[model samples]
Target chain A: MLEVKNLTVSFGSHTVVNNVSFSLGEKQWLMIVGPNGAGKSTIVNAISQGVPYRGSVYFSGKDLAGLKPSELARKVGVLSQRRFVSYSFTVEEVVRLGRYAYSSSIFSGRSDDDEAKIEEALEVTGMKPFRGKSVLTLSGGELQRTFLAQVFAQDPRLLILDEPMNHLDLVYQKQMLELIRRWVGENGRAVISVMHDLNHAWAYGTDALLLDKGRVVAWGKTADVLTNENLQSVYSMDVYDWMRSLLSRWSR
Target chain B: MSKRPEGFKPVAYILFAAAMMTVMVLCICAGSVNIPVKDTFTAIWNTVFDLPMPEDIPWSIIILVRLPRVLCVALAGGALSLCGGAMQGLLRNPLADGYTLGVSSGAALGAVIAIAFGIYVPGFALAGTMAMAMLFAFLSLVFILSITYRLDCSLSTNTIILMGVIFTMFANSIMSLIVVFAGERIRSIMFWTMGSFAGSNYVNAIVVFAALLVFGTAILLYSRELNAFAIGEDNARHVGVNVRKVKLVVLISVSALISVCVSISGTVGFVGLVIPHMVRMLAGPNHKRLLPASLFSGAVFLMLADLLGRTMLKPLEIPIGVVTSFIGSVVFVYIFYSSRKAK
Candidate 1:
């Protein structure tokens, strides 16, 4: 459903993502994992057309760069590392903003019950109770859920999320991943997410791409790519033993 | 979630519009020339329907003098407030306005130069004044941005405001020089700088209203895009808002309207600075409501301010800028205290 060909991104003389190429078919959930400044967000930013890049990112056979912002947005929904809402807008209003590509003009208002897609999104994200709450007063976890509901409402075929659950609580993180799993279970839908938690990636990702220093260290089925050798080399630490030790701390 | 949040509220619209019209009509009866409210209404009705005027003294007052001044005041108020509302949305900072961005000073500089040299566009002095003011306003934004960029690549809020202040000081110094050299026009320059609606007429009123209608509607149309910025510009872009295009259209339109306002009533302080923040507090920060509320509320606020300035001393009128700054500062203090307390 999406393709990145020799994607290279840089800042002045500093190269952040170098000659990284990967592709995903429909129903695939590709998890990008790396340490700090591993260019996970940069790669996602490049795919979402938020940054200029040397290589092309094709979405459903169309080059994303050639599309208008609204056109690109129709096919791609991105949940960024969220920022705080300082104003007094309700969560519903913020979520409704995701439908900008579908709205007729900037002046158009939210549609009625007949077009209740947004309401459905709010429901799935478990933000139904807080839909009317002012986003400014929301806690970090609630705010993240509100934005997650927003991306859900955008109803794009491909979801690109950069550390989407960073602000979410543990239970909500599981719920968010479940929602994504359900979403990608459908036809013609896929996801590319940058995650910090290897456990979540191993558990949730069907396809995983491990990146180190902006280059792809391993890429294949999640089970194949997240081997002890691959994880140890990229992280410079023992992977399975560390998980076992952490589990032992709470063991009976 | 079965019940959607409120969308557009016609009640608020009707209420604001009615209040604006009512205040504007009542303010027509101000000034020492005591025209009765009945006469004011009759003259206004006659003029609206294009009937032949009654040819009385009150008819001339309503048709010729009071009407234009009132319109100019209302337009300036709406223009400045809308400019502030849009700037606050684009910058996602409540403090962003023409005054803080040095755009108002740039506009005042333009108006001052035109008045100093007696520059007029043949028969239309208003055009020359507005043209020069708009030019300087745009240039001032560009200059402030360029200088700020040179100093700080990130263009942080601190750097931008600092540049604005530096530019404002430099522009004011030059304006002072112009005021100093004016031998005969010193009185007019002083009045212009102080911000007043004295001797206004139909030409100034109609031209400014037309400009406001165009630019003001532009801002209103872009309100949704502005709403997207509430999260932050980067996220706004992620949601398909062409942030750059929205910013350019809004800022240019705002500067143009503000230039027209300054050309009419010389940098009336705090209408822009205070009105949007006040309206946002009352109406909530959805730009859809906030921008339009700023429009009507600003009109009423300025009308009351100008009227008070005109009548408070009877014979000795206070400057409109002085009245607003005095009142606005008090109201702003209360807002700060209340917001802090709420926090």
Candidate 2:
């Protein structure tokens, strides 16, 4: 299980993520939804140790206060919304970097298991065909999948993806969400995703955390926290009645 | 796809670099004087083994003067190019070079000031100037970097470039003022500005060669970290890199290399700017291969430039700085046009 207690992250004098507390059980999927500047990304960044925050994050019964980046990477894999590569690394070479945390030593020869994991990640992400191609020349959807393959290759206990569906098409969006859901369900690992699409979050997430202006407005089971009134208030849209009718139809 | 194993590629690159270094050393030895290959080996053997010098052997001509100067040129060339390549990776800017951050101008101003004031015992003036240049090069780097850090803005690529230009202009004005006031030293200052490898001896050559070896190996050891840094500090940190530590290492190593090169060659230009980009064009930007390749190729390139400078005008040796600029500008123009055509 992963737990965050009173997580408060500030920039200068302004608090971007204030007093946010939550936990995720094994095999659970928690989706965070908020409008722009609602501090959703900041919260994920804090939990992933990408930014400074004033609180305690406990993972697997250990405080992550002074842990180094490599140690944190061993247990938590993070995929930020922006992905940039300055060189023309081949897809296979790029995927191999994910195994850096698992390697016994910097100079040690790669084991067969490492190669196997890489191959499996590529296969699962449907990137097997582009393994030898340079990632620099890939299309947007292909590049996103390549990064997903890298995350899968990492094989961390906890996966945190910030807007993983940004550049993906409809088919890739379905493929990626199904893949993450299956991974969590089968492996009993925790997955937290920050998403903007309310319908997709409701469809795929087992739990939901809603935020407004850096504070958690609601948290719990997806169905309960995603009520029409909460959606209308958080999103500031009058689509609650239409969303309720659609939810009822989907339930049937 | 077949796997070549994880660490094999970097080893191959190292071996290639060694081979290139050997070829460059031989080329440096075989110069306008046209010493036979056998005689060159004999001279090297006698010097290393401390054997009795043959009555006919030319010790002063071969070992004492030409060899040390040649080695110094090679060392400065390799160090400047390698540091330039690493700086480009660290700053994530293709235009970054050894001289880009005002280091060359700072060194030049320091040397000129030392010269104008005659800040040494009569015979030790050049040595004092070199020491002063090294000191000023490091100080200038620290000053610029601290100011940039204190500004509390993201160190964007354009901002770094702008700061570098501003600092360069400041250093240039100081150097110009010194040159104008000390009119009698203009000839010496002009010679120093147009770099020459005239008086390099074994003592200074050893110092330069050792510094280059240490700095080059240090940069190569951090090749993976440099590759991570090229993507940006935030991305590097996200990927589990200690960004601050890596940046410090790169900055210190590059600064040391530049200082040493300035001490020896008096601000030879364009090798740092052109060679690394040419290497990247050929080998891609992976520092694992790029660093070592730039080192060897840079040595060869500068040695050839030195040979041309010496041989082009037989009795009157041209300054190496002019030769390198002429050759480098031609190559750069060709590369620019070809890349544009490709686009």
- What is candidate 1's lDDT per residue for B32-127, written digit by digit as tens? 677778889878898799877676647877778778888899988888889988887877766567877889889999988887887779987678
DockQ by candidate, in order: 0.59, 0.41
Q: What would the per-residue lDDT of candidate 1 be over residues A1-79, giving only the tens digit for each residue?
A: 7989999999899999999999999999999998888899999989988778998888878998998878877899988
Instruction: Give candidate 2 regions above 4 Å deviation.
Output: A241-252, B1-3, B6-33, B52-58, B107-159, B179-194, B327-343
Q: After superposing candidate 1, which stretches have Cα over 4 Å from the reference?
A: A106-114, B1-14, B42-62, B114-120, B145-162, B182-193, B333-343
Summing lDDT over every window of 10 consecutive residues in candidate 1 chain B, give the lowest-scoring window: B1-10
Cα DockQ of the candidate 2 complex: 0.41
Deviation of model 2 at A235, angstroms: 2.5
How accurate locally is residue A122 in candidate 1, as Cα lDDT from 0 to 100? 88
- What C-alpha lDDT does candidate 1 achieve relative to the native structure? 0.83
